[model samples]
Target: MLEKIFKWILTIVGFALGYAATEIAKNWGFINSIIGTSNIYRIGFISIAIILFGIIFYIVSPFIIKLIFKLTGFLESGIQKIPTNDIILSVLGLIIGLLIANLLITPFARFLAGNTILSIVGSTLTLVVNIVFATLGVNITLKKKDDLYNVFTFLRRFSKDKKSKADSKLGISQPKILDTSVIIDGRILDILKTGFLEGPIMIPSFVLEELRHIADSSDNLKRARGRRGLDILNLMQKELMLPIEVVERDFENIQEVDSKLLKLCQIYNGKIITNDFNLNKVAEVQGVPVLNINELANAVKPIVIPGEEMNIHIIKDGKEAGQGVAYLDDGTMIVVEGGRRHVGEVVDVVVTSVLQTAAGRMIFAKLKSAS
Candidate 1:
């Protein structure tokens, strides 16, 4: 029913345009002479023109509708790819630019008075200027939004008579910025809930974008991990008491997420909370503080000394013959020499030595009797 109404509206618009064309044609000297200034003939000519245009529009309306639908879908998809804050800033900039353009054109419009061709030219120029300025404004605003935000925030701080409640809510110190890997690991949420982490937790816009891309990835494992990370983030926001802030500031020139995160930490004078080894190393080299979850886990694991005895269920064979492997409750690997034949059975092993490496801690042991 809606489609039928749309087609009728198109037909009516076509008829109106056809009538306007006939009026313009009647103003021509040759056409006026041909029509002979008769009201009956003029009405007949206009009716014929309307009917012809109405039929043509009716036939093409479906194609036009399909094209419009396709264009709408394309625009919707394209808009979805841009962050919400960016779109808002771009629109604001465009509006401001058009307003400025109008102010500039209004004074000059009077100069073209009584000259139809010049007036038309002036109007066209105004429209072109508005479009050009608006486009330039959008590009400039998007590129400089972070700088503008900082300037406005700084000025507002000085202008205020007293600190607002909102300002007081934020900690005096910088926030801990979370990267994609830490969020995906899902331990950060638990850590935040425990009240061990201080200040508001900051999630950069680019990190969220990276998670979104991962969630939409083709690989099943990656998609699941990404979706789990998103779920963990939502849980942290809704269920945890900690303040979580999604920062809009982003380094557009930086292509790597880790690189952007390090830059963000530098900009905000904040620490990065992540489990990615490479990122942790980079942050250290850059003199940025990083709270590595892996390091924390390793720190909290139970300490073992030589000659310590513990019972473990041998789960698999190690690289060497007769060597069985097991894991501690905290996931520390234990290599039991000469226990491969006892795989799938519980055995008491005496710790011989403990090795700590960048990856994790490992313990070597042998049967209690062998020790």
Candidate 2:
């Protein structure tokens, strides 16, 4: 029924177009002279043109309908995926652009009034300017939305009292943005639960999507890690006092998740919370603050001075001969020199030195008797 209605509408439009074309042709001096002022002939020509156009439109309507449906579906899906804030901003931008276009085109419209061709050109120019400006406005607004939001929030707080002044002095605590590796490591939940992390915690939509991809991966290890991340997120949301916000904003132009996280941190003036060493280094290089969980863990571990003694069970051999490897409760590696012979036994060792690397802290030790 809809298809039939659509075909009928197309037929009517085609007939009107044909009649308009005939009228335009009739206005030409040569065609007017050729018709010899015969009204009957003109009527017959218009009737034939209308019938031909109507038949053509009816035959082609199905393909046109299909194309329209495809375009509608594509647009609907795209719009649905866009965040509500972005859509609102884009619409606001479009309105501002149209207003600017109107201001610029009014004078041109008046100047070109006497000439039809020039008037058409002015109208086309107006349309082109409107489209270009609208597109630019939307793109710019979306890209700088976080900054704009911050500005507005500041303005809103400007009228507040002494507490706000103190807050200003203390500096606004920017949200902590979580990355994929941090999520998979799953210690973030505990950190947040401890109230050590201030400000809102944000997980970007892209990061969540990456987690989903990992969770769906065919590799068992990756799948487990991904699932663990998701479970941690769920638990954080359920049991933690701090709200975990899932941010829908994304940098569509950025392909790498780590790069996107850094860009987002710049936008939000936020620190990234992650266990990824490479991400931590890159973010630091780019002047973005990073809260590395591994670094934090290392910092809080028992500080062992050289000559301090502790007992450890040698579970495996180290890369160096006669060096037995043991792990602290916190997963810190302790290398015991001359203790390879004591594998599978617990023995006293004296800490000889401590080495700190980007990865973590390592303790070098010798058997207590040797020390």
What overall lDDT, based on C-alpha atoms, would model 1 receive against the true structure?
A: 0.87
* Model 2 TM-score relative to the real fold: 0.59
- Give the best candidate by TM-score: 2
Measured against the true structure, the TM-scores of the candidates, in listed sequence, are 0.55, 0.59
Shift of residue 153 alpha carbon in model 1, Å: 21
Q: What is the lDDT of residue 196 in candidate 2?
A: 94
lDDT of 2 by residue, 107-167 (tens): 9888987899998998888889888888878888888887875665465445335544666
For residues 1-371, write the lDDT of model 1, one tens digit per residue: 87788889989988998898898888899877877879988888899988988899899999887788799999999987786668888998999888888888877777875699989988888889899889988998999998875665456445432433444475355579999999999988888878888877899999999999999999999999999999999999899887889999876556899988977786676789999989989888766789999999989889999988999999999999899999988799999999899999999999999999987999999999786
